[model samples]
Target: MTVELTTLAAIVAMAAATVLTRLSGLLLLRYVNFSPRSRRALDAIPPAVLMAVVAPTALATGPAESAACLVTALAAFRFPMLAAVALGVATVALLRFLGL
Candidate 1:
């Protein structure tokens, strides 16, 4: 089957756009020096965004999820973000398996 010209152009354009966007972020950050406060704020962004997205779904799902979410939030304070997320997922899985 032959690829249409417009489809091939669209695919190339999207790839170019994605590469440019990523390179722009790296280039922009190379010149900027963050203050301690600004740095801390930037560091907090990932977990904050994760919670903002997860919390509502957890609350709506049921007690097992809500409890798991709490455990995950507590873990985040003591562990790295990846560890915290893993613990949260494990907690939810265990709780669900236990029929909670």
Candidate 2:
């Protein structure tokens, strides 16, 4: 069906994107010389990209989302990424339960 085909196409596109990003350093090194400043910039790119992607959604959604974001950032200070994410999830759930 068309829907199934569309889903398959989306999955394929996502996979291609994942592969491209993962291999990007090797691909770029072949054609480009990375200076120290450029290397530092490249190292910062992923977090900047992540913040750019997450900020709008986290800020615009609602109080619960904002609270979860804050909780995650705070937890991240003392815990690992996975634990911080779990704390965020728990925070959203608790806030929703309390009718926030």
Candidate 3:
């Protein structure tokens, strides 16, 4: 295959994979009967996913970043998720600017 053809093939494969991943969730939901508790568990997926992604990085970074993560997590508990994220990011930026 030429370079252009190879690139095109790779792009097509990626698009196919993305489409399959997206569609699989909907397809599974159509056939699976979710109980109320199961639905609740599913609803918690996003935050659990967020913590899974964020916790490791927050822990690995230095004090300011760690503090920011705590602030963010606490703010998240007290306020809206968006507000909490904003507060966390702002706190980190300010701390970094101060050379902490």
Candidate 4:
């Protein structure tokens, strides 16, 4: 497969940027002391970021995906995360199969 020079350069640049971002966060943390409340807030960032990314796509996709998102959210409240995820996957598959 032939890769274009610009595409390759873009991919390499993205990788470098991602590495720099992660390394900068690690290095910055070493010099900073956070309160317990601040630490807890920092810890919550990852899931919030994940949901921020996933929620919009889920809601925008279609009826099946939207329904699956709701099912997953409700499932998450009552079941383990893994179970909730599995149920969401199954729900989407079933809904799609049924032509929703």
Candidate 5:
């Protein structure tokens, strides 16, 4: 199917807007001087962001999937980061294979 010029332009604009929206926070952080409290809050943002991104995906697949993710996260916390991720992926794969 051929996309019309106007449709293509709209898609490009939407992509640009999405990119700018994602980057706006980082840009502001780089350019603005944040207070100590703000810095602490900023430090907390990553874990919060990670949860926000991962929670739904994990839960969407059910408790077993979420448990696998949690295990992987905990392993990563206790062991090598790469190993943790590998274990998590492997756990999910195994579970899928076993028909969980």
Candidate 6:
């Protein structure tokens, strides 16, 4: 089925709105000053954001996935970031291979 003009326009508008919403923070960064406290907070943001994104997925997937993520996170904490990521990916792959 073909999409109507109004529906297409609505989709375009929604896409633009989503893009702008995501970019708003970066755009505002140009006007803002980074203080020491803000810098520290920014450093913490990546781990917090990563946990937020990963936790739900792990929980939804089950214990095996959660264990994989934990192993990966711990490795990342103790070694090179790339190695940690690789550990996590490898754990997931191994788990899948084992039919877990």
Among the numbered candidates, top lDDT falls to 1
Q: What lDDT score belongs to each candidate, Candidate 1 first?
A: 0.90, 0.78, 0.83, 0.83, 0.75, 0.79
For model 1, how does the per-residue alpha-carbon lDDT over 22-97 read when each residue is reduced to its tens digit?
Answer: 9999999999999999999988887888788788977798988998899888887778999999999999999999
lDDT of 6 by residue, 6-75 (tens): 9999999999999998899789989999999988788666566666667787778876698888987677
For candidate 6, the per-residue lDDT at 87 reads: 83
Over 1-100, each residue of candidate 2 has an lDDT whose tens digit, in order, gives 3469888899999999999997996787899887999998876655455445557858798898789887776675567566877888899999989988
- Compared to the true structure, candidate 6 yields what TM-score? 0.67
Which portions of model 2 show Cα errors greater than 4 Å?
2-17, 20-50
Deviation from native of the Cα of residue 4 in model 2, angstroms: 12
51-96: candidate 4 lDDT, tens digit per residue:
5655895868999998988887777666766787789899999999
In model 1, what is the error at residue 76, expressed in angstroms? 2.5
Q: In candidate 4, how many Å is residue 71 off?
A: 3.6
TM-score of each: 0.78, 0.53, 0.67, 0.55, 0.59, 0.67
lDDT of 3 at 27: 91
Model 3 Cα lDDT, one tens digit per residue, 1-100: 5569888999999999999999998898899998999998887666566567679869799888988888887775567677878898999998999988
Higher-TM-score candidate among 2 and 3? 3
lDDT of the structure predicted as candidate 2: 0.78
The lowest-lDDT stretch of 10 consecutive residues in candidate 2 is 45-54
TM-score of 5: 0.59
Higher-scoring candidate on lDDT, 2 or 6:
6
Runs of candidate 5 with Cα error greater than 4 angstroms are 22-25, 57-64, 72-87, 94-100
CA RMSD of all predictions: 2.5, 4.8, 3.4, 3.9, 3.9, 3.2
Model 4 ranges with Cα > 4 A deviation = 1-11, 74-87
C-alpha-based local distance difference test score of model 4: 0.83
